[model samples]
Target chain A: MTAASDAPQVRIDGLQYCNWSREIFREMRQGGLTAVHATVGYHEGFRETVRHLVDWRTRFRDNEDLILLARDSGDIERARATNRTAIFLGLQNPMPIEDDIGLIEMLFDLGIRFMQLTYNNQSLLGCGWMEKEDSGVTRMGREAIAEMNRLGMIIDLSHAGERTALEAISLSQRPVVISHANPRWLCDSNRNVSRTVLQALRQQQGLLGLSLYPLHLPNGSDTTLRQFGEMAAEAAQIMGAEHLGIGSDLCQGQPDSVVRWMREGRWTRQAQAAASFPPQPSWFGSNLDFPKVSEGLRSAGFGEAETSFVLGAAWHRFITVSLPSAV
Target chain B: MTAASDAPQVRIDGLQYCNWSREIFREMRQGGLTAVHATVGYHEGFRETVRHLVDWRTRFRDNEDLILLARDSGDIERARATNRTAIFLGLQNPMPIEDDIGLIEMLFDLGIRFMQLTYNNQSLLGCGWMEKEDSGVTRMGREAIAEMNRLGMIIDLSHAGERTALEAISLSQRPVVISHANPRWLCDSNRNVSRTVLQALRQQQGLLGLSLYPLHLPNGSDTTLRQFGEMAAEAAQIMGAEHLGIGSDLCQGQPDSVVRWMREGRWTRQAQAAASFPPQPSWFGSNLDFPKVSEGLRSAGFGEAETSFVLGAAWHRFITVSLPSAV
Candidate 1:
């Protein structure tokens, strides 16, 4: 391992939803991760999602040496001081809240600091990226967003469609984030954000964590680390260095069946036969390989301070602003 | 409004926990209710509680003129040929399937015909009626009481105590019903079950659904119904009367606060300060007063066909043999 002084100053991955285990925790330590915004729920409803929280509590207890639950930016700082990776809970879908608006406060109390309004279809809140007609945020979505803003929870729009994403940007009183998505200018997938959204995100002082999932990469799974880093540099030129950071969207150690569940949930009766786990790019396979992207950013003509900011400090700054002061 | 000849023959009041609309489905077609089980859930888990089914997709649309989601006894012969009142869904506590159990075939497919393990305290599977030391259910109770035996899903042990109820009558190979409790002779409380549990119910294939909701009313709630019907004389007899019936744990047109939550759901942070509703014993205050309970049993005492059995037959017959042939 490199000397402690050589490590990036504040290495936080803006998002990850790995099949977490002690091995992964060790890899986060190896990767010099200060913290991770970990996805806790997608299509899971409230009670089932509480079970997930219980599972995470067990994990936190079992792995106390390597990780701690991060409730605030100060927790992240404490993790860095203790040489542990802080895991902040996030949700990729609003299904956990179900139809009840009161549950927003309940979930926030349970340590969920971030939540997306939709996943890949029409939700009670908003439309997902895959929905054909984006009606923007629904009536319930507006109430939920207002509650989230009051509680200072980050509104994520990573899986939201064009109009919904844009509307959320305009509606949210607090700055929001596209926690894991590339610019559509770089990767033409529906999962990536358009240039217009990026401009609005920058205007609103929102953060954009560039994704490294294969499908969102320009050259898919064959994309080189250097090429990926250069794309980050180009995105920084459009959205500025202060808003750019890495959110690998990593799916390390997950089986193929889990991928199907993540996509299909219980929304449909039939299995999503066509959907399967894609091959991860060789340049960045897991938390252990996070340093490769940091190194690539350096090699892509970024200065020392700018590289550190893009690597993690940008996300740290965003979180410090996003999370509630009291919570 | 109909003549006595045109009135529905069967009348059952298995249970009810409605946030009752005052309209009352035309007073259950003026009190000729063929069957009524009519209770939803208590301390239910969020997603799996089948609120969608309770929302009554079919009842709200196609079958509004006839029934209310009874999955038994041919929907009470199609609500006595469209006069309408067949509402059979029972749940006393939330501990039936727990989380690990696979939604139970009877619950998911057949719509939860009946479930009662506990209502007063901690129950991994058993122990109710406020035991000082809840030893919890025996190993068999842990195995699959939620799975429901082949005959039908009627496992009511109304406010049972620890050891007696948790033993579950030697793990119950077929089906069992305590339908309602008036058993101070067994344990001495509003929540006791008498030696009849060991006797008539086991030997004669009888059911028991006797409750007036004024806490085991021998004298409470004015006690007139007891004398008017010779309830003591009939109950002293063997359980040959097809297991007796009338679980009138009724609270109709209750205030919204009464239904704010059945138990203090996890949604609330504070304990419910005023935990009890007002007294409700003005001679069957709702569902058009259920006059059959008063008039029929009185005439039956003069050597009719045991009007208690008539009052109970539809429910007993429904539960004795089977749940719905299909959902």
Candidate 2:
């Protein structure tokens, strides 16, 4: 049960969708995680999304000693002070808002601070990475961005198409985030961020939370700590070290069916043959292994300050400036 | 085509659930209504409530010349300046939020300013007037009141039981409203506001919008404008004159099935035998007849200022203090 109590670094995983349990929460505490952006919606609409919120509400009640729902940066500080992990609710798709633009503010009021313009397919807001044709930001997408900006809700472009991502980066008055994605130059997946988007994000002073999920890594599950460090170094070179953090796309304890639903939610009649979550890199398997990332970053020639920034400080600063006091 | 152009009084109907149309819009204009708190939900859940919002959105788009959605006092002022009525969305029941306290802020963000704690039956929040055993504000209801007070959403108790209404009046940090209820002394109906509740409302500086629904009137369809004025006068005595306004409860152009749904929304196994909307009093059939009520109030010895206050100024003042600007 050794923890990262040796250092006072603030650690935040920008994205995760674990089969949440008390064990996982205890692991988070053990890893010294100050906060984590947990996905609450993928393809679910408003009503289903509400059920997820209720579930989280129950989890908060049950695990009050280990975790607290994070609505703002102050909540993160509070969680840290109380030695608990702060969970920030997010949506990987726009379905939760359905077709109503008013739901944006509604969701924000319910503590949904991050919303991806798309998941892995086309959405009402923008084109997803899997779409054959990228329509950039849709008419509703532009309005959603403006509303998100006004409400101080973070706009995540992790799963969005390049055109859509770039357009959103340009359109948002406030800086946007690609909450859980790596560089296309490395992994070359459609889900990875492009150089153009990276540059735009850098220019707009936005953030890129590098993913640890094997699919987004250069060498899948075999991705070594050295390779991860190298990727971080390259990412830092492209989009200043100040704008990078880890968004471990963790799916701990989840069955393959969850992944299937994620990829094929009522959108298609045809089922995909294989639909299991990819295994994580050995050195960074769970919340308990975050210290290994700090070591990896250090070995990759990052200064202590840069390592801390990439670990969680940047996310803290970004989220503090991003969310309003109350919806 | 002659309208209420002779007077510049701010006229607001505290509650309505009309079968909206351009003709209705024209009548609203003819009435010189500054605003109307229009019911968007009776027993509709979150998704259904959103559909109602979408419907209202379409109406707002189609009839932009006649009405605009009001979010605050400024919107009401804008509607008056533009010679259009401001429509403030509301719920006659707590079904829209389901059992989640979070949905309160969500619906408020969607421009729902007023929400009744119960309809004609027991809800999660409290007991409706139609119920035999009247439970006061439930545990969730207290949390809802705090959240509403924080968000500036108006606590409406028009259809709630006496115990529920009184408990809500005492529990709410902000002023609550009996948005559309007559004096129980006048009508002797459970749906009407009790003298005790009226006194409590006055103590809390709350507003009581007298209902004109025939069932809540002294003689149903035979009730005259003078009788209505006397009710208002007595209500003004029970509550302060500043706390009295008109919530016409005008279900204009709505079918009998609509009333049936309102009275029996999946609540019971037995079907209601009678379900038709009652006849409106002769002098107050539609929005166009608001001036007639004003004349009746004047005839009943209401001073010009008091008449205007009852017409709309009271609701205007009450609502301005009762809603937050953003989510």
Candidate 3:
């Protein structure tokens, strides 16, 4: 591996939804992560979102290595430089914004950098990827986009509808992202963004997080890290490595309840479809961890430069562009 | 006042988002409600939903006064007959369903009777009041509706989009309802179901709960039982007493955190606007206990039949049709 490929990767679990419990904090610490974009929204709502922040503050009041709040690119750099795990608050949907576009700025101020247009279904913005009609951005959705743009919030389209994601990519002046998703060419999972969606994100200088969830990959069964790397390579072929990063939708040590919460349709409190899939989801996740990516790069026989970009260099670009150059 | 009005009235807080704390249980017992449809889905996704049932079982397990797991109409009568507060398991949003339809029956088997189509924003079924576009029901949403109908779960449109709610009411075979809503004519709050939406529910033989939230009514500053009664009475005039009931949205002693969760929007754990509202939502609640509706009826000059119908009869019909005959 080139020096760049081996450059101490600042691993970011692009998408992870865990409880505000001590156990989860401990698990994140164990994941060998330098930074994690932890999701703070879902059934609990926005207040719970803030409470999560407070919880981190309480947990790491003095011991900053456990978890620290990341508000800008500088924060992420500091965490990487200091060997700390930085938690960048993110929302899967704009539901917390409710009907008020003003809230976009409010939450942006609260250190939430990555925010998708919607969760699994719909929110104040528009339909999610799962929505059948794939409703594009609405009038209010436009205003929300503008607010998010002005606030410099990374427009994450991981769980957003195709038309809406494209519309958002086109509308925003800055780079956006599919924070954690696989390619639809591989598997037609709702968690996978369509090629068209990827194209739009690419055109606008956005990013795509190659998801570790096998369900989102070409094969939901027994996928190895090599396949995960191949998928990232495929995306790199399209969006290029600069816009491709590791956004592992990782969930380690979360209770069965947490997994169940995600499978439930978007924005549902009691929304569940019954337990058909296995309780544990991280089997494929194990293959997609940061270290595993190194071995996968070998399987792909990726060029040194490309492998280097696939590692942390790609994410480094995203973080740099997302925050102000001044910082 | 008529003798019927004076007769010990059976009251229910209808819907409450409380922690089921010992104090909360005592508050319910003291509130004089024969039962309360305590929300189990919002904070408790799947396991926690069960946890609430278990918690209630333990809290009021042997008390005999607090009936745990009353999922249908029968629980109310059994609770009323047994002098216990019937605890109904309801979901504020269908998020627990996640992506599976079969889970609907599983949840039904668990005694989760009433389910809101969407939370403050969106779900698999449709867009919520906060969603920018009323894209009506998506494909999965229709399936969810059909599943709920097949399982005999009561469909709640309280937080649904105007078009979606109207469409759901039309699509539903069983009567649907806005478990908590005010006439849009009463107050212009988005929380208030529009006249057209209410009419659709009325046409479908659905019920409308008269929420005690003063902002939903025109009489916010001078709010009183009389004004509240008039709100229901007006609903009765438009949709008849059979379609009228009390949701109360009676959040008493509920901390600011809980309210923040409610208004924070459906897509997240909570909204950024959490805590932007009042701490104690006790201003509008059943102060005289559950049977306070008896006083509300008498003070409003409602006759024996009207009082009976509004106070408990409306709910009785709703439960009878939705649940088993026992309620």
lDDT scores of the candidates, listed in order: 0.74, 0.89, 0.69
**lDDT tens readout by residue for model 2, B37-117:** 999979888888987886787789899999998888889878978999999999989898988887886677667889999
Return the top candidate by TM-score.
2
Which pairs clash inside model 1? B207-B243
- Model 1 chain B — which ten-residue stretch has the worst lDDT? B101-110
Docking class of 2: incorrect
Q: Per-residue lDDT of A70-92 in model 3, one digit per residue for the tens?
A: 77767766776776677778887
**In model 2, what is the error at residue B147, expressed in angstroms?**
8.7
Tell how far residue A61 is off in model 3, in angstroms.
Answer: 2.2
Weakest 10 consecutive residues, lDDT, candidate 3 chain B? Answer: B274-283
Clashes (N, CA, C under 3 Å) per candidate: 1, 1, 37
TM-score of chain A of each: 0.96, 0.97, 0.87
What local lDDT score does residue B108 receive in model 2, on the 0 to 100 scale? 74
lDDT tens digits by residue: candidate 3, B240-316: 87677778776666667676666663446634653633322233443345465557657666777776666667777
Order by lDDT, highest first: 2, 1, 3
Instruction: Tell me which of candidates 1 and 3 scores higher on TM-score.
Output: 1
Relative to the unseen true structure, what is the C-alpha lDDT of residue B161 in candidate 3, on a scale of 0 to 100? 85
**Candidate 3 local Cα displacement, residue A246, angstroms:** 1.1
The best candidate in terms of DockQ: 2
